[model samples]
Target: AIAGWTPVLDVCVITGEDGPHTALVISAGGVVSDAVAPPGTPHLRPETITLLSALLIGDWAVADASPDGARIEARGIVAAYAQFHLERSIRSLGHIDRTE
Candidate 1:
């Protein structure tokens, strides 16, 4: 995720019972090791990532602008919003050939 930030997803895992049981995974950790969403879950909304980036970085400008996760530099900010499905923005965080 972000250089020093992690992703956050409100997951509600439900199970069958007399009524119903649900487990919410609000925060896990870095995507490098944790999985927030399930394997069957899909990551299609970029807005979610944007809001997450804002919450994680406490920067509205950055978060509002990162709703797309386009540039490689923007992956961290995006992944910071996705806990289990952090792969979507991984490719964006590539090696930058800029030393200036």
Candidate 2:
């Protein structure tokens, strides 16, 4: 969680029937008092908390669109965060230079 941000965002990645699923635990009303999530949720802290919080606050529509639920669900929050917030559109990274 970033400084001055609440209600204590906790994220988790769990294997589901389809694949990995991201479970979010958000504190109620941005307050810590009612922050307890439902049972079986993992306690996770994002490495890039400020960036993630900014993304969540600004670009939720882009962030929610993922190929697979598992795609955005990872123990490494950076990948998930980047895929959702940083990625602009799908594009080929490179093309084969087949002149050999």
Candidate 3:
């Protein structure tokens, strides 16, 4: 079993040409999983599927060059995830120290 916090990130991208696309990313115990849907995927607007697709397919150039709202959202998600994990790890270490 994965013994760690798993945060789900919802990233949306909106551009002048394409509408909006959304991608759901989940990271658990160093394993990453994601899913991207095209336009008209229930409550999500079609935007960032292109960016997610690029990342999924290992198109670094496209993903890196993406200058859209998705990029900002992605960065924020990563920061939050890192902070959360760091805090959790620190707390876990403190508990271990107290017990020992």
Number of the predicted model whose TM-score against the real structure is largest: 3
Q: Where's the lowest-lDDT run of ten residues in candidate 2?
A: 12-21
- Name the better of 2 and 3 by lDDT: 3
| Each model's lDDT | 0.40, 0.35, 0.41
Number of colliding residue pairs in model 1: 2
- Give per-residue CA lDDT, model 2, range 10-37, as digits (tens): 3321222231122343322221112343
lDDT of 3 by residue, 28-58 (tens): 3221222334333332122344554565557
Against the true structure, what is each candidate's TM-score?
A: 0.26, 0.23, 0.34
| lDDT measured at residue 97 in model 1 versus the true structure, 0 to 100 | 45
Per-candidate count of clashing residue pairs (backbone under 3 Å):
2, 0, 6
In model 3, which residue pairs have backbone atoms overlapping below 3 Å? Answer: 20-45, 20-46, 20-47, 21-46, 21-47, 21-48
Q: Please name the candidate that would achieve the greatest lDDT relative to the true structure.
A: 3
Summed over model 2, clashes come to: 0
Model 2 TM-score, all chains together: 0.23
Is 1 or 2 the stronger prediction by TM-score? 1
